[model samples]
Target: MARTLAEKVWDQHLVRKGEGQEPDLLYIDLHLVHEVTSPQAFDGLRLAGRPVRRPDLTLATEDHNVPTLDVLAPIADPVSRTQVETLRKNCAEFGVRLYPMNHAEQGIVHVVGPQLGLTQPGTTVVCGDSHTSTHGAFGAMAFGIGTSEVEHVLATQTLPLKRFKTMAINVTSKDGRLRPGVTSKDVVLAIIAQIGTGGGQGYVLEYRGNVIENLSMEARMTICNMSIEAGARAGMIAPDETTFAYLKGRDHAPQGAQWDEAVEAWRELRTDDEAVFDAEVDVDGDALTPFVTWGTNPGQGLPLGENVPDPEAIVDENERVAAENALAYMGLEAGQPLRSVKVDTVFVGSCTNGRIEDLRATAEVLNGRKVADGVRMLVVPGSMRVRFQAEEEGLDKVFTDAGAEWRSAGCSMCLGMNPDQLAPGERSASTSNRNFEGRQGKGGRTHLVSPLVAAATAVRGTLSSPEDLV
Candidate 1:
């Protein structure tokens, strides 16, 4: 039978098929855990006297509550310290591999997995965090699981899940490529804006066509990382030469003859030409510009040159209510130019946009420029390896010279579990995913943008694009 790429991968890992309303049991190839969500699951195992069924496939990292400034010092917050220590204790007892804070390999689970060649095509991957969809960039069947499911997978190496319908997001341009300065982040923000936040509910999104094919692996990951925000079960791209090239030499990737065999198998991991999707959406990549979110949700966005939307003008009743709430929380006035909204902070890091390429892009824009007076800018790499690469290329110096704080990596201000966060009523132009109220800190406002836009906003002290500074 002709199959979609997702269907092909799903069938490959199917340990048991569903009958009637029963969920199918799918084997998990990679299980990633973090401090915030795993402690309870570990305790569940201990209470039941259940051992981790496949410790070799499980990995743990400390990121959600770790500080970015001090690597060697003990965590100052009692709650944060306990979380990290508990993870250490659990991993030690369970025999699962862990990359603790200050370890050379330590970083965000999503970022570290791909960097270490642990995320590969045609594999089933899961994590407790929602952004685990980030691994789908490699054509893996990756999605987030809950704590109970975490225990289930740890105990059985399998998850009971309902099969998802597929949605094809076909992005193309009249010229067959995105315009320069319109990045993958812009493309994704534009998608959410077009479809609204719940458009992909109960669906697995397949990003395809010319625009997707042209994007680099890092850029693809950035797009897939936000699929959860769009309410998709996961998002994926078909494995191709770009996917193969990115995984060829990583630490955990197959080597020698095994590598050749793996590549041969991965080459077949694509949708059949005639396979159909439940729904389809098309985006004009050329028409997209650098985008920024004006309201709370990722969908509440517009091109950089647009104005804050008027809530009363919204046609949908629910949308109008959401717009009103967003405007009230954001301190934005109707019809105010988004570019005129001043910012108190500029953050350039997260699993969504904290790779070496993201840092390099921000550095290129900040190259001889200074951050606006009084606007604090924080540049946290996604992982220790990314930090080392950035420093080796001197990208760190460019950011520090521009007055941004170059700090060690963890999931810093993206969700504000640690010290890197905004003060009350503070507004920021950030490169991370999501801009919900208090996502960065209590009473904080977030404007999500691309790295280029983030650097430009840091200089201009407003939501901006590189053209604004140029």
Candidate 2:
């Protein structure tokens, strides 16, 4: 029978098929843990007198609670310190491998997995993070699970889940290629805008078509990382030569004969040509430009060239209300040019756009430029290895020379769980995924943007794109 990519991966991981309404039991290929979500799960295991069934398949890291500026310093916040310490103790007791703070492998769990090549095609991955969808770029069936599910996976190495409906999001360009300034970030923001936040409810999105195919693995990750923002269970891309090449010599990737066999099997993980999806959506890549969110939710975005929309102009009552509230919270007025909105800070790091490629791109924009006066810019790497790589490539110099602070890896300001945070009422142009209320800090206002836009914003002190700089 023909099957879509999501269905193929789901079937391959099923250990016990559901009868009637019972959920199917699926074997997990990888289980990712972090300081923020693992403590309670570990306690549940202890209370149940259970040992982790497959520690080898599990990986833990200290990211959410680790400080980025002075990583070696003792954690200042007691709550954060407790979480990191508890994670260390639990991993030691459970015989699970953990990458603690200051360890070279330590990073956002999502970034660490792909960087080490532990994320692979046709695998089932679960993390206690919404952005676990980032691994889906490798063609894995990855999604975030709740605390109870995390404990279940730890105890049994399996999770019970109903099958997800599949959706194909075909991205094409009018001229056969994207415009020079359009990036995966812009493409995804545009998608969210078109579909709204609830459009992908109950479905796994498979990104297909020429524009998606031409994107690099890092760019693909940036796209898949934000699937949850559009209310999708997950997002994925088909594994091809680009996927194989990225995994070729990484730490956990198969080697030699195993590599050949692995690639052969992975190549077959694609959706059959005649397979059907439950729904289909098409996005025009040519029409996309740099995109930025003006509201708390990701769906409230427009092209950088557009102006703030008037709530009265919206025909839908609910939409009009949302727009009105968003404008009030954002301190924006209807019909105001987006480019004129000034910011107090510019942040260029997050699991969504904190990879080496992202850093390089941000540096390219800031090479001979300086951040605008009164605008503080932070250039944080996603992981320590990414930080090392950036330093090796002199990207760090470019960032520092542009008056941006270069810092070690961790989630940093992405979630504002650690020392990095925005002051009350502070406005920022950030490359992070979500811009929800207090997502960066208490009462902080966020405008989600791409790395290119982030760097340019740092230079111009507004919600401006790289094109605006020229």
Candidate 3:
């Protein structure tokens, strides 16, 4: 039978089939944990007197609440400190491997998994964080689970899941490649804008065609990372040369003869030519310009040249109501030019765009420019290893020389779990994923953009692109 890429991976990991209406039992190859969500789960296991079924497959990290500025100092917030300490105790007692704060491999769970080569093709990956969809960039069947589900996986290394309907999102560039200044981030925002936040509900979206195939692995990861924002259960790309090349020699990746065997198996993980999807959408990648969110949700986005949308212009009553609320919270008026919007902050880090390639792109734009007066820019790497690589390549120097503050790795400012956040009513051009109200801080307005756009906005003190600064 012809099968989609998702179906192929799902079948490979299926441990048992469900009888009519019951969910199938899928074996999880990796279960990633973080400080915020695992505490209750660990307690559940203790209460039930169940030992972790597979400690080697479960990995934990201290993120979400770790301070980006002081790695070794006692965390100033008592609640955050307790959470981190609890995770340490749980991991020690359970024999699960943890990349704790200040450890060389410490970082966001999603980022660390991929960096350590633990995420691989044709595998099942899960985490308590919604952004766990990021692992699908490797052609894995990856998604987020709830705390109860986390405990279930801890005890059994398996999950009961209903199969998701498949959606094919085909992206093609008119000129055969994306235009300069247009990035994978822009493409994803464009997709979300085309299909509202609920469009991908109950579906696994497979990104394919010329444009997606051509993106670098890191860029592909940026696309999949935000799949949850569009309400997709997960997003995936087929494993190919780019995927193989990225995993080639990473620490946990298969090696020597095993590597060759793994590649042979992964090469067949694509959709068959006759495969049919439950739904399909095509995006014109070459027509895309730099995009930014104008309202609260990611779906409330427009191209840089456009003006803020008027709620009255929306035909759908539900959508119009949402637009009105978003504009009020964002302190934006209908018909205002998006490019004219000024920003007090610019953040360039998150699992969505905190890789070394993202920093390199930002640094290239800030090479000889200065940040605009009064605009505070923070550049946080996604992981210590990513930070070390950026410094080795002198990218950190470029950011600091341009007046942006260089910070360590963590989920800083992305969800405002730590010190890096905006004050009330402060607006920012951020490279992070979500722009929901209070996502960065209480009453803070966030405009999601690419790293190139984030760097340019810092220099121009407004939502902008490298082309605008030039």
The Cα local distance difference test for each model comes to 0.95, 0.93, 0.94
- Report how far residue 182 has shifted in candidate 2, in Å: 1.2
> What are the clashing pairs of model 2?
none
Q: Candidate 1, after superposition: displacement of residue 91 in Å?
A: 0.2
Model 2 ranges with Cα > 4 A deviation? 174-176
Q: After superposition, how far is residue 458 of candidate 1 from its true place, in Å?
A: 0.4
- Give the distance in Å from residue 324's predicted Cα in candidate 1 to where it truly belongs: 0.3
**With candidate 1 superimposed using the best TM-score fit, by how many Å does residue 57's alpha carbon deviate from the native?**
0.3
Q: How many backbone clashes can be found in candidate 2?
A: 0
Q: Ten consecutive residues with minimal summed lDDT in candidate 1? A: 173-182
**Local distance difference test, candidate 2:** 0.93
TM-score of each: 0.99, 0.99, 0.99
Q: After superposition, how far is residue 183 of candidate 2 from its true place, in Å?
A: 0.8
Each candidate's number of clashing pairs is 0, 0, 0
For candidate 1, what is the lDDT? 0.95
Tens-digit lDDT track for model 2 on 207-264? Answer: 9999999999999999999999999999999999999999999999999999999999
Q: Which stretches of candidate 3 lie over 4 Å from their true place?
A: none
